[model samples]
Target: MSEQYEYVPHRLLRHRVRDIASGVEGELMAVVNENVSESGVEHWKELAYIRNASGREFTTAVANVVPT
Candidate 1:
């Protein structure tokens, strides 16, 4: 069977971004896609990991970040 999905690195990787809701600014460290299947349906949830200047890290939805 053919593959149903393709995995690609997010454009913001290694770039600086800020969370729109929390006003947190940091370097984008990684992008993670979590696949969810329910009732024969499948979808992906994109998440981002960021590290701040002070070395603090946090996780947030990819949609919440904007280029800094």
Candidate 2:
């Protein structure tokens, strides 16, 4: 007999700041949601809002798996 496995979902948001002169990047924030998972195995999805020094904001989303 085959054992059934449960799937879990997770959400995380990460931020980074870039230094133009030094060409270095630094992490600003990391947001995690514990209630996003149904089981121990975590599946992650990310959404990012990036602001540039010129005051321009860019948004992006990343997913672990694509659903059809």
Candidate 3:
């Protein structure tokens, strides 16, 4: 018999910035290509993206398993 793996969704998670001073927020994605951050934080990834009224884009910092 062949074994099958249960499907999981990354969008169920919310990624937020570690430093509040950065003024970032949580976001959702269909998938996370990378599981590590540039500074190296465990169980976190930068997949969320944001933008201002000016239409400027900013990359998210981290992810939360549960909504905050």
Candidate 4:
């Protein structure tokens, strides 16, 4: 008998910064929001509220499985 594996959707926060002087852009930060179990079940809720240096508030919600 063959075993089947299930795929679950994961979510993450990807942030990037842009340099106006050099015209360069790259990823600045990445945060994992959720983690899925071996059975492809999400065990936690992904919710984060962040504030930037510019006083900008950003909220993100993701439901995914990630390694801790």
Q: Where does candidate 4 stray beyond 4 Å? A: 1-45, 62-68
Best by lDDT: 1
| Local distance difference test, each candidate | 0.82, 0.36, 0.39, 0.38
Candidate 1 structure quality by residue, lDDT tens digits, 1-68: 22343444989888999988789999999877766556667776777888999999897888898999
lDDT for 32 in candidate 3 is 34
Candidates, ranked, lDDT: 1, 3, 4, 2
Better of 1 and 3 by TM-score: 1
Off by over 4 Å in 3: 1-21, 24-32, 35-44, 64-68
Q: How do all the candidates rank in terms of TM-score, highest first?
A: 1, 3, 2, 4
Off by over 4 Å in 2: 1-15, 18-45, 62-68
| Tens-digit per-residue lDDT, 1-68, candidate 2 | 12233223323223455434334344323322222334666554443333445656543332321111
Model 4 error, position 45 (Å): 4.9
Candidate 3: residue 14 lDDT (0-100): 40
**N/CA/C clash count, model 4:** 3
By lDDT, the better pick of 1 and 4 is: 1
Tens digit of per-residue lDDT, candidate 3, span 10-61: 5443443222436434443333334443444434444434443454545444
> What value does the lDDT take at residue 5 in candidate 1?
38
